[model samples]
Target: MCECKALPIRFDYTPKGKVEALGGDLEGYVVAGTKPAAIIMLYDIFGYTEYPQIKQVCDHLSAATGFTVAIPDVFRGKPWSMAKSPAKPEDNLIGWIQSVGSYAKVSSDLKLTVDFLRARGAERFGIAGTCWGASIALTACSQPDGVFEACAGLHPSLFGKDKEFAEALLRPVALVSARGDPLETVQEVVNGKPDLAPKCIWKRMDDVEHGFCAARGDYKNEVVTQRVAEAVQLLAGFFTSNVA
Candidate 1:
């Protein structure tokens, strides 16, 4: 089985983006883009309020790529309670996951956000996510009705369903795998990108653990900060290359 381990909650940083209404059910933190190309920044189980670092990353990507970066509050303020680390069926983390259950459920929420974006004149699109959000980002792109031009999944926890993620790729993708995440599995995901497979890349950050590029990232650590900076460049460059 694929491994998933949640780290301690972090509260060291602040984000510059502003939270605002996009339309019906389109509330999120955003950095406006001039290219009219936008990226949906998906969050981990921790949600945005408790882990502001998610928005910081979104800001970094927005700064680096000059694209509109936004992460909607899909949880509606009720995210994983962090009652359990590894997650048990009885815990709030699993409960939240079950509530969101599959990407289809989350996709319905995303459709609202996408509709808001479309109404705002957004023409190009990209997506990036961490952990559970990472899994959904990949899963979303695999769907026949997927609208993203490219996708980036940082530290995806596929839970033994790596093949499904690989086979679901319909566009260019970049996966930053956490240390100890199966290399072959992530490689298969990039390789499964059909005619666009050549543009897909799997970057393994052996120095960091899962969620290093998202909520769990320790910006205080110089090493993690450096790695996250590299990830910023990688993801920003990838999105700008295709979407911008």
Candidate 2:
């Protein structure tokens, strides 16, 4: 396994937002707004149920960008834990993915999320994810009728060696990779497809590792806050130009 795939042990964020059912057993932490554009945030293996930093990020994006941002419970209620689980991290991640159903099912769930937002007056849309969630964002972008006008992936995972998936993206996308990320493969894919070059933005965080966007609440410093702020800015800029 790559070093970047390791999960952080800290849980540093203070939870935010009101819990609301998103229909069909799906629930999410919604930062409400009256904006015409909405952003859907997919969670990594850790899930978004009790994670404070993830919720904080969602809230920040909504407040900062004036876009309705929703982070759905993709794992339903059963989020994987690195601190309490007995299995290896990799095994637990795989199990969690399988438990939620296949990739197709996850993709369908995302579409449902988009529909839910659209019904609430949101016209354009943006999607962002980290790690495992990044893979889902890619899938969402591939949907023929997807509502996403823009998408962003942070230290993305699970996008196999094949280039067809990357080639399928139709909307503008920003991919932020950590220092050790296997982004060369994706870059190759983008390079080979001249049509995709204009629509794709690749940013590299030379000093950070995967999962650096979330705060573990262990340190009361400015570093994590700054990093998160930078990431949000990048996504915001992408959405501002493409969706907002």
Candidate 3:
């Protein structure tokens, strides 16, 4: 029984393609709490439109920790349909990956988000993502003096043999992965890296695949769903300890 509840949110459309940044209107949700903390979340390749499950995650996190969660639409203003998306899921993910603002284009997206929440009377900040969004979460925190005081990821996709991205990640972060996931190889590469942030935390679950958090039967497992809920709880705790 999750006490998670969803609050109405406003979308502030940002055109990043022209600005060359993490553009698009941000999707915001507030959960009932006293003195809410603020957090930003990124979605996976399936895009935010495909699954309503992520809203549950946001609501759950907010209910557990009193955080004002904001999820950004990074799909270039394009919605995705499970049955009608043009590119394969992986390709769609990669496209968004390549779309993240360059180092020079970091702009005010993150900072503006922090300011927005603070303006709404929030006091703490955090970030989290899943699958493709997981990597972005890590990178966002890696920025010097990142607005997010705490961050987490489940089944992150940062398992490349190279440390290029990992090295840039300089903030404390948590990673949750499934042992049976096809992307487990990438998880291994990330966990095995020697230069991971001193605050990087890693957890691996067995009998789960890449998109276990997704509601789709193809990737969802009851046990794994339980595991993901647990992971979300852990992330809320981290945000509590570090952010608020």
Reference-based TM-score, model 1: 0.88
TM-score of each: 0.88, 0.83, 0.71
Q: What is the C-alpha lDDT of each candidate?
A: 0.75, 0.69, 0.58
Cα-based lDDT at residue 221, candidate 3: 42
lDDT of 2 by residue, 1-244 (tens): 1012112222464444676777788888777765788999887777765555677767766766778888878778776675754457666556657767346767767777777888878888889888777877877777788777777887776546336657777766788877775466666777776765676677887767677764232224456556666666667666666777
Worst 10 residues of 3 by lDDT: 10-19
Model 2 quality (TM-score)? 0.83
- The clash count of every prediction, one per candidate, is 0, 2, 3
Candidates arranged by TM-score, highest first: 1, 2, 3
> Which pairs of residues have clashing backbones in candidate 1?
none
User: Which regions of candidate 3 fall more than 4 Å away from where they truly are?
Assistant: 1-25, 76-81, 84-96, 100-108, 159-162, 180-200, 215-221
Candidate 3 TM-score over all chains jointly:
0.71
lDDT of 1 by residue, 85-189 (tens): 667766655556867746767787677777777766788888888888877787777778778988888887776777867776777888887796644766765
Model 3 global lDDT (CA atoms, 0 to 1): 0.58
